[model samples]
Target: MTENKDKQPAAEEKAKERNWISASLWADKEDIRKGAERYGEVKWYKSARFWPSMLVLILTWIGAAVTGSYSEAVGVSVILCPLCYLNVKGYRWSLLLFAALYTFDRVSVLYMRAESGQASGSGLWWLLIWWLVIVGATLTAFRIENYRHKHNLAGRGHYVKDTLIALAFPVVLIASFMAYNIFMYKSSLTDEQRKALAFSYGFISRNTDGVINYCLRSGVELQKFPEQFRQTYADEITKVNDWLEKDEIFKSGMEASLQENKEMLYEVFENGRKDLIRLTIAEETGEKPENLVWKTEYDRMISPVEYCKLMDESFEIMNSTGFFDSFVETVKTLQ
Candidate 1:
């Protein structure tokens, strides 16, 4: 009887040693082992809420699969599937992991919306719904974990490291994503598109003046291409020359007027600037104020002489590129 008592004690110690070794490894495996010992072979299906929580997760996954791109879906699955398994098996650290992912995702979406200055009510509602569902699923996992603890079925492990790792995941993932983009990036623009964009940028760079406002004040109808062409290349060149002549006349008029009314022009410019500042503020704040329009042509008031010089340079650039000749040739090819 004495020997039997000694052996029983030794066996119990061995069992405890085994349990400790199991628990120290990974929480999910430990939970399953303990749960199986206490709640029969079908340990995972012990809780009534388990299936429901898992159903929510599965549906969320399906939603992502349907809505997201292939790469995004795969990425989400890699991170989410393991969390789902661990969470269902009663890992509370999974909550922190899920929360980290959720925060990153929501923040990214909000930032994009802020940048674009547009977000539909329906889109926001859907995001809210997604958040609520995640919270609900999280609460479900907490309850299961609590139940495991109460039943002496929960895994014994220090989760501090796990929580810290969960927190670091977003940072790592973001860094990896940025690195991938930096290294693997390729331009999607065609050669023609690139050339067209380059030409547009050139014009934009040379546009020091508010050309629309200048044309409005000068009574100059800027020459339109092809549509305004008079059935011959020579006629088109004449039209361009006429437009340039009108621009010169407008510049001469501005210079002479500046000589006469320099101080008056300065006052007009300052007042126009104040009006523009007020207008910009009102627009940004979504407020409409009376007399928001500039009292004078604010754009024309500041550096009218410089504006004429820039316009001449812009014309020179347009002509120097053989743009007119190439456009005519392209149109002829189409014919």
Candidate 2:
């Protein structure tokens, strides 16, 4: 009888431990309902997770507004506002969403830098630290939610006020940035500079993607029509370039547009060069290439020099097509 009494206490102790573990590790509807009854709906707003997330959210918006990344800022705001709301309201899945977003954004940034041949250097370390902080913050948020559930201090409130407040950050920041752009930046520009900027935008909208698409689609037959295609394309480009070269405004606008998008241009040309190499090797090995290679009906692989020349001419010809007379008329209207 005494032994049975001792065992009964031991079993009770084990049960308590199990209950504690479940409460800390899991949150179901019942526990949340009980928490709401115990602590009321506003419990989430008072959470340690809530204020810090808010601070970080506001700081992020501020950073974006200060930098020239207005569009990116607006995009992040749209994505994060709802996540922030759900997170503060004790939804555990919000933490997962946060981690996933941070990972994708950072990885894409790194990939773009590498693609552009920008050295990571110390920036990589900063990115590593940033990733670590994101992971740590997410884990901490999960722990906070768990703690609240364990203590019956968490509840999913209507959070209408919280939602409005969260959404206001992005809305206000975007509006402010737009006002600054229109009143400050645009107003500061001279008439000539404004015209140049407009011309630059028009030129890129007309030429850049069309040139890239043409390069990716068209191929030069260096053996059969080598001199013929090259000569004709060069003549067309020379005519357009020569006509535009006389105008100072056109030169400035074209230079600025090209420089601004040099990375994209470089990527297109580099990929084309790689495709040519891949096609050449595939022919030699009698194996299929992994990617589509641009080739003419002749389907003959050429030397690297010939490939480079072909790409150069293609870029110039595609950029020059229909742009010469169209932009000449555009320039006249601007004047």
Candidate 3:
């Protein structure tokens, strides 16, 4: 019985040794003291006081000039000390200063919005909420720092959680900004309004899709159309121009149709420009005009005026065949 008791004591000692080693490993893994070394080194900058502060002030001025938000830049600068308080001395004073700066910024934004006759909506509410979050996060970070001073809690898992909480405000602010941009894009236009705007911008064309595809396939063919073919195309275009000039109904109908398909026209124009270079190259290669490659190339090399003429003729042909409306609708639904 005595021998067994003695062996049990030795086993306990071994377990204790193992536990101590494990704890030492954890301490090494999560050493906040090593991380704080950079904070300690920042004392030299703090000692320089006026010069460093003035540099930040100058940087704020530069940011204001660049961004056209002087008040915001100044507000950010005023709050910088509190934001960096985790790595600096006089953290309490910095926190107070930051709170004051935030209050001033809120008042200024409200005043500006009022002056501009803009409603104080989600953006203003978000700014207020963000300020509250910043205050809460700053205080939490300070409390954590104070707790670490009294107890060795700095290297624990809780410390990492606290660090994440401290980062949450900035992350939320960035996310809100992104959400606002997306909302603006979606809510700025109605379906009919968007279609009308696109049409007015020059998107209407009976052969827009085929032309765009042809251009994409053989942009170089546009350049290959001999000067004679261009003249023929031009003469055909002039004939339509003369007809539109003489017929008010035809002219008005053409304008209305174009207004409806403006977006498609813009897309085609942009796409055609890209295809022009390719069309020029294809023309030099003697590709047939009716070939997809040649047609695409030809469309790309055609000027806006020429393209409009082609589209008008195509629209007239489609209308005579009773497919103009269907064709326009189909092109409208495409990119």
In model 1, the Cα lDDT at residue 243 comes to 30
lDDT of 2 by residue, 102-149 (tens): 788779878755544453589888877767665555555576566677
| C-alpha lDDT score of every prediction, in listed order | 0.48, 0.55, 0.44
TM-score of each: 0.34, 0.44, 0.24
Q: Which stretches of model 2 miss by more than 4 angstroms?
A: 1-67, 81-89, 119-121, 168-264, 267-335
Encode model 1's per-residue lDDT on 1-335: one tens digit a residue: 99999999997786666542233222354444454355434445433224433544466568756743223443564577556555544576675567567767777887555333345688888877766655554554465466667767756764676555545655565567556545653423344543443333223211222233233243332444222233335543443333323233232333344335534533553454465456665777676745456444545443444433344345546556774565444333221
Q: What is the lDDT of candidate 2?
A: 0.55
Model 2 / residue 125 / CA error / Å:
2.9
Kindly report the root-mean-square deviation of model 1 from the true structure over all alpha carbons. 20.3
Top TM-score prediction, candidate number: 2
Alpha-carbon deviation at 259 in model 2, angstroms: 13
Tell me the TM-score of model 2.
Answer: 0.44
Clashes of 3: 29
Q: Which stretches of model 3 miss by more than 4 angstroms?
A: 1-87, 149-335
The candidate, 2 or 3, that scores higher on lDDT is 2
Report the lDDT tens digits of candidate 3 across residue range 1-335: 99999999997686556432232223232232332333244333432212223344466689768744443443454345324522234243444555566567667767645433343588788767655554443443344344455455444334455445545645664565446445533233445534443342232232433243333333222332233223434443343334333333334445556545545655665565546545566678776434534345444366655654454445445456764354345334432
Backbone clashes in model 2, listed as residue pairs:
none
